[model samples]
Target: MDKNKRILSFLISFFMVISFIVPINAEKDEKNIFKEILKDDFEKNSSIQEIDSAEQKIYMVGVEGESILELLDQGYDEEKANKIALDIQNKAIESIKSFKNVKIGEKYLYTTNGFSITTDRNTAKKISLLPLISSISEAQVYEKRVNNVRNILEIASIKKEYGLDGAGMVVAVLDSGVDHTHKDMNIDSDNVKLTEEIVNGLKSKNKITYGKYFSSKIPFAYNYADDSSNVVRDTLKERADFSHGTHVAGIIGANTKDGGVTGIAPNAQILNMKIFSNNPKVPGASEDKIVKAIDDAVKLGADL
Candidate 1:
């Protein structure tokens, strides 16, 4: 009887130890998985502070590195770390209240605190933020009146009379790639064979002259200080960094035979010289690339 009792007690103690160890190990594994996923998402030593506003969530970035890691180490999850970051950001914003002598990075600090200001970092000029303030009440759309202009039927009638139903014109779009497969924009017919293909270095056995691909969505130009050669490329095979050039191309040369809207220059051939992307936050296209594209366009005998 004594031996049986001792064995039972040892079994109970062993089960308790196993139970505690399982959860701890599981939690550790979970943390490791989360860390792996988040490691690539965060900027190097950078933190983001989310500010809750009535209108939109404002995020302040580029917080000091050590402070962010320290918060993470304190058992504060990512959310708590972000909140503390915002607190620090709000403090920095409050420090620039008077705005006597503004430095380069110090200009827009007060916008978080409900003040507007503009600064030219290169020239070191300060401008009144008052003009920057706008309201929906002050907005108005202008409608232009053309003499003897009627409805769509009248335009169609005129087009028919002039025999200008857009028969033999090609427009080249060089913007973000067109949504060729869009329900309203797709071109289908035996005579009008529209092809979508990527323009990178590889060649496929079944070659269709034109098609869509991921690389064509990149921007035509960027203005950052990084070397243009590292980011920009001549062939469409190179990934498009921005979608702006594609969008522009769509506007100027999307196939109109498919009952889509006509472009400003509908008859022109679209030679997409993708040079800039959708949002050109950077300055502009590289000068050499721009010049080369222009020279190629001119050599192609483009009317423009």
Candidate 2:
């Protein structure tokens, strides 16, 4: 296959691998919870930390918690910088008690400036602004909103009135990876077979594209002083949150399949920009990778 075709094939196979995940318990309930709490925060909804974006679990990446990279920037050695990041991650954990789901990857993917957290957004936000965390955006959705809203602005209504189903639209999902075979996604190609026929079928769909924008892996290390492309590529042998990207893709343009859930824009095209990999049991996606995904999306002619 040519370069474009080769890239697309990898994406198709990637989607096939993740889309087949068997939903664990509470999957349905978690979606309801996400819609209730995250319907308002568009950023959170799009973030890797979003509910069900990673097998219905919370996933976070941090640089502020340990401040390792920051310390190195200030002239600290690798050992000292790692020690500092771990220290901050630990202290912050104790100071902000009651924040559950916090974990620091031994390899060091974190949430705050010192380390990463996996707690609810409200608590994370509260702690993030304390000068310890570099940014408050890393928090999770804390309290579940009592009120539930769907398409509150009536965008769906407007789209319907204008007879728009996002046909010819290009939407990007910057997450783990997507399962293209989900019944509700309206995707007809399940290129999981990896045969030439399956590959060509995936290419024909044209609705889902991959590797055209961002690469399967980023070439830089978290420290930026050295290249860890080999390490990253090796880690990527196992990707994380595969279902999350697929879920987001389905939400954007999933067509109705066998009476399954239909997407808001059934005809819109979807792009798979996998930015994270499996780490710390659940696998992880980092912030810098996300920024790169956004750049790739914009360059790929995505309609915003």
Q: In terms of TM-score, which candidate is strongest?
A: 2
Question: Considering every candidate listed, which one attains the maximal lDDT?
Answer: 2
Summarize candidate 1's per-residue lDDT along 1-304 as a digit string, tens digits: 2443233233323322322111111222221222333345534322321122122211112222223335666787756664665566555445444454433221111112112222222111111111221110101111111122124344334433543422222233332333333222322222211112322221132121222232212212222223232223345443343334334444333345656564322332344454433333533333223333443333332223
Give each model's whole-structure lDDT. 0.31, 0.43
Off by over 4 Å in 2: 1-149, 187-241, 281-284
Candidate 2 C-alpha lDDT tens digits along 89-167: 6665566554554444222322224333454544444454444444333312211112222442354455455555554
lDDT of 1 at 202: 16
Misplaced by over 4 Å in model 1 are 1-161, 165-167, 174-243, 256-260, 264-268, 277-281
For candidate 1, the lDDT comes to: 0.31
Error of 1 at 191 (Å): 9.1
RMSD in angstroms, all models? 27.9, 16.5
